[model samples]
Target chain A: MDSIRLNQLIEENYQKIFLLALKMLKNYEDAEDATQDIFLKVYENIKSFRKEAKFTTWIYRIALNHIYYMNNKRNKEISRFPEAHEMRTEMNANPSSVLHEKELFVSLENVINLLSPRQKEVFVMRYYNQLPFKKIAQILGKSLGTVKSNYFFAMQKIKNDLQNQNLLEFQE
Target chain B: MKCIDKNILLDYLNDVLSSRKKKHIASHLSECGHCRRELEKWKKILDITQEFVDQDVKLNPVPPHAHITQRFSKLPQNDESSFWVRYWVKPAIATASLIFIALMVFFFAPKTVPELTENYYVIDNVTYTETISLEDRYLDNLETLYLQEIYENEELTYDILYGDWQNYEEVLNDLDHDELEELINKMYDNEIT
Candidate 1:
């Protein structure tokens, strides 16, 4: 793709991709970096993109792959530098007031971040990106049933977590 | 009559069901308290998640980076000739050269026939056939092993496992007494759950 078309693609997808990265990575700085890297990858590989596939689906595939790569790399780094990771967690935990005021959000983010890789990817794509399950299946290269089940399981987990914490109330 | 499938309820939540199906679900929700409660639980979760996302976005607006576009402008142009030269022309030339060399060797190379007794001939033929069969099986086994490794190691393995909030444990472990007390104080101050 030419620079003009590339710019257009970037403009259209920048926030959506960033949000996916944010939800997947759970850190603002890392998400920003991942977003930049994903777009750069898109720019480099635009020639290999076939006209037969939907552009958004193709872009989403690239974005998800990049996020997974980043996550794996981060996991390896965390395992390598356990002390530094603990210190950072300590620093982030220092802001107790901010966290307390938004405990539900923090808890929700925690539940989301803890989801299994497949479930997290499906949930982020469906909930945060608002992509249809069929489109999510196309992007993830999984069957539609697999995508929907992953999403359902993710939702069930979130509901159970909220209920256990008594963050949500409902008549029995 | 039966409780709605969780997947269909999700579809209803997402508004992806067809209007007729959507109406069917709506009517069912009125009569089935169990399904209605299920839907309400999902709806509340969705609403809360949306609120969280909204607050996050408000706190951190992602403006597009100018440096990315600047870098894009610096990338080499996708010239068609360069593509063919890199992907097609060089490989084609190499293939043609190999074919030509093979043809030359077939036509011009000297061939020597080995003298063999009848017993030696039979033994050699049997050994050759056995070697060929063994090699074919060996190659088939190797290919299967390689493909199995790839399938197992593929990055996007969609296993059907539910999340159990392990990170929440990690977070709880990271907090000390003072931090926990501060967090509780703030929660009480804000009257938040």
Candidate 2:
């Protein structure tokens, strides 16, 4: 593809891709690096893109792979679960409706981070990105049944965790 | 479909299920209070997650360094070094050095004795009854007796001395008239020469 096409792809998807990396990696610096790295890798391998899969799916695949690899490489890098808890406590301190949505968002993020990597990915694709299970399966290079199972298990785990944390009571 | 698996219900709410399946799961959700409540909880979670997506992630989306894209651009487009270049460099260099040394030795060394034929000699003089050689100098022959000619009446036996033994003494007992005449004529010829 020409530079113009590549530029358009980046302009459209840069934010989503950056958010995905940031969500997975937690730290801004790491997320930015990961994002840039992911883009560079995408640019490098753009020729290999098959028309059968969606571009978003391919980008997410690359982003997820990069996150896992980065996490695996540096054990000292902590998960973003702390921000989730911090935001939860921070949100409760202010009793305004404006912050209520943000608090719930933080709670959801916490719950997401609590999930195992596979389940978290499946959950993110299924719920956060609103991706279909078939596309999710393709991005994850797993069978559709496996994707379903991952999503199922992830929701169960989140339910259990929420119940344990007493966050389930807030569901109306 | 007995108790809506909360997970399946989540999929259902997302409209990810087929039409027939959604109807079947919806029936199960209505009949099952616990499943219904769980599904509500998940809907809340999804709503919360969507809210998070809308909220500012509180991150500087601008990459830390302005030159990050530039850095990325400069990274080796292809990481592979040429295969032959990596492996053949040392061997090619060594081969060149070896050829250089061989050529030096071939072109710069001194000429050898074998090239000049310095070990041979030639001798000319007389025939011998036996193979004979001088004591010191190999160029001289050392036979003391030789037949110069066969006469009608008899053969003349003369002593031939070579090298330092050129002074020779004859040991003949009698001399015939022809022999005497021959000896006399030889002596006379010697005197005249």
Candidate 3:
């Protein structure tokens, strides 16, 4: 029964979790290891679930905790994470704008890595997961306003940083 | 409506605002140039943010190796009673059986008779057999006397080492303690004198 549930969970969310770990760890092997470890943890701790939070949210929190632990264990190195502004500017500015389009997608990845842990979480849940603000608030245990504001702050920072670098031009 | 604050603008961009508030923000957008421009920036941020959203964040499938799931299934689940027993029991039993067989092989085997240590020589149609007393202890020095000990026989041929030699364990089983000691002392005396 536990294995069945674990398989179900992995099948459903493995990709998202992999993406999270990849973005967080910024390497393929580490992300794969983290994903495997995360599932093992879920299998072990599923009984303690208690249903206090949404399962998806609980899983995300577990993944986040794993990534955080790994980051700490690795001594908080962000060298693999590209700078937030540089990604945005490079993505938003291009010769044909098509260059910026592909670059933007890749750069967004770097930007997500560059975000502060809190900002990254909120941003990922909002954008990647497409999770509702209320759900995010529940998952984060933060108020709706707090969640919204954090997201706002993240977007604002990215915008300002990109603009300062002259990578993004807001047309008049 | 105080031209919808930045927070409201953000909420509006995220499409989180209620229908009525959406209408109010829309009206404010038409009237207030600053808010409209702020709204445009937020929209661009939204558009830019969409770049990440459209991306499919997928974990690469596990590489082809030994099956991880199969291996994991073989592991004992945590919920069973005596989970440790489930994990360690089979391995422990396997190890004990191996040790037991090894001990029996060590202590109960028949002893080699040093007087029956056949050394052979072939002379025309006749074969001569010279038996050497090789105590197990003298076995160590056999390498030094290997050339002199060579036996040529019709059945054994010119090769004293023709047939495969038994393992030391087999040799150990065949030689009794006293015979082994006598054989060793004789070989030592022969070497010295």
Best by the TM-score measure: 1
Candidate 2 local lDDT, A14-88, one digit each (tens) = 766666666565555567778888887876776676453377778888899899999776444325365665665
Backbone clash pairs in model 3 (N, Cα, C under 3 Å; residues 3+ apart or in different chains), count = 7
Candidate lDDT values, in order? 0.78, 0.64, 0.67
- Could you tell me every candidate's TM-score relative to the true structure? 0.61, 0.52, 0.54
Candidate 3 — which pairs collide?
Answer: B110-B173, B111-B174, B111-B175, B112-B174, B112-B175, B121-B152, B122-B152
Residue B166's lDDT in candidate 1: 61
Q: Is candidate 2 or candidate 3 better by lDDT?
A: 3
DockQ of each: 0.23, 0.13, 0.13
lDDT of 3 by residue, B1-193 (tens): 5767887888887788899989887887888888888888888878877864664342234333234344434545445757677678867988999999999988898876554425322223246444444556556555445544444335554333454454654786789999789878988989534
Q: Worst ten-residue run, lDDT, model 3 chain A?
A: A92-101
Give per-residue CA lDDT, model 2, range B1-193, as digits (tens): 4576665777787777889998887778778878877777888766755656555343234444334344434444232557786679767988999999999998988866453333343244455233323344543322212122322214222222233223322323356678778877888889634
Candidate 2 regions with alpha-carbon error over 4 angstroms = A47-54, A76-105, A170-172, B29-34, B56-193
What's the i-RMS for candidate 3 in angstroms?
Answer: 6.0
Superposed model 3: Cα runs more than 4 Å off:
A1-8, A50-53, A76-107, B56-193
Among these predictions, the greatest DockQ belongs to 1
lDDT of 3: 0.67
